[model samples]
Target: MLLFITIGALCLLLTIVGDLVKLLQLSKLFRCISGSACSDELQQQLKEARVKVERVRQSSNATSHYTYTVKLMRAENELKAIQTKLRNESNMQNLKGASVELVVGYLLKGVLSLVLFIITLRNRYTPVFLFNENINFEPLEGLLSFPTGVHNAISVPFWALSCNSAFRLLFNAIKGK
Candidate 1:
């Protein structure tokens, strides 16, 4: 249906916008980290730590500089991995995409219901011609209103479940389990 398609398109657009915002935030965070103004004492501490580390490396009598360099690189990689894990956990807790998708799905469902209502009106008996046996019309109208509410009610839980399942799968794949 045109209504459902339109709704899906709009939801896709919203998802893109949300992703862009996230990317922007990440960029901003990176810039902040690179541009931060550290106190002189902290800078001094870092310098001293670097010097101490270098001294320790030199005293260790490692066979080659290559070994020290490789070890340093591996430590950096581990630190990055830990930071990435923390960020991912925080993002999951926020459920940013799930919230956005839930809203979009509900809106789409409402549109679908409205379109159905319009179609029903176009084909139904004239409003003015109330036959004696048309006592069911009021109840039918009530029934017609149910789809929109049902759609909204179902979307949040559906999205939540989907996201949870998807994340679990992703986690398993990442862990090679």
Candidate 2:
């Protein structure tokens, strides 16, 4: 049926689009691809902090003057502070990005599934495919016929499920995962 085919295509399209969006991973892509100005600046600061600590350490023997100890401790503390800042910044960005992606993925799935549900309800009495003695199982025939009460006819709900299952399986196979 045209309705069945169109609905199947829509489901396939949505599944592909959702996977593509997941693959894009835009937030992490932007942050990782360029690691842009802010991250670069932080990296530069981290390097300078390490250099400062090393310079101070090299300025004196490990057990030299009290002034040297104070300088070395201060430099090391600065280096540690910078390292912690960089770690925290990266962790926060990852958490925020993942959270946003999770929320968006959840909403997209919910809304699209809702649309499919509405369509299925509207076409509850419609037969997605008609068969003549193709399947002889009574319970299955009863279920496949669904609201239409037509023996050996598949309904929209099962068709939708089959479409989603087949497409997702094909997609994963193509992705080699």
Per lDDT, the best of the predicted structures is 2
Candidate 2: tens digits of C-alpha lDDT, residues 1-177 = 797877887688767766656777966864575446777888999899889888887888755699898998899888898888889888877877777667777777777788888888899899888877865758678877778887888888878888989988998899898
- What would the per-residue lDDT of candidate 1 be over residues 2-52, giving only the tens digit for each residue? 433343443344334434445445443543444234433445554555565
Q: Give the TM-score of candidate 2.
A: 0.74
Return the TM-score for each candidate structure: 0.26, 0.74
Clashing residue pairs, candidate 1? Answer: none
Backbone Cα, N, C clashes tallied per candidate:
0, 0
lDDT of each: 0.45, 0.80
Model 1 gets an lDDT of: 0.45
Best by TM-score: 2
Clashing pairs in 2: none
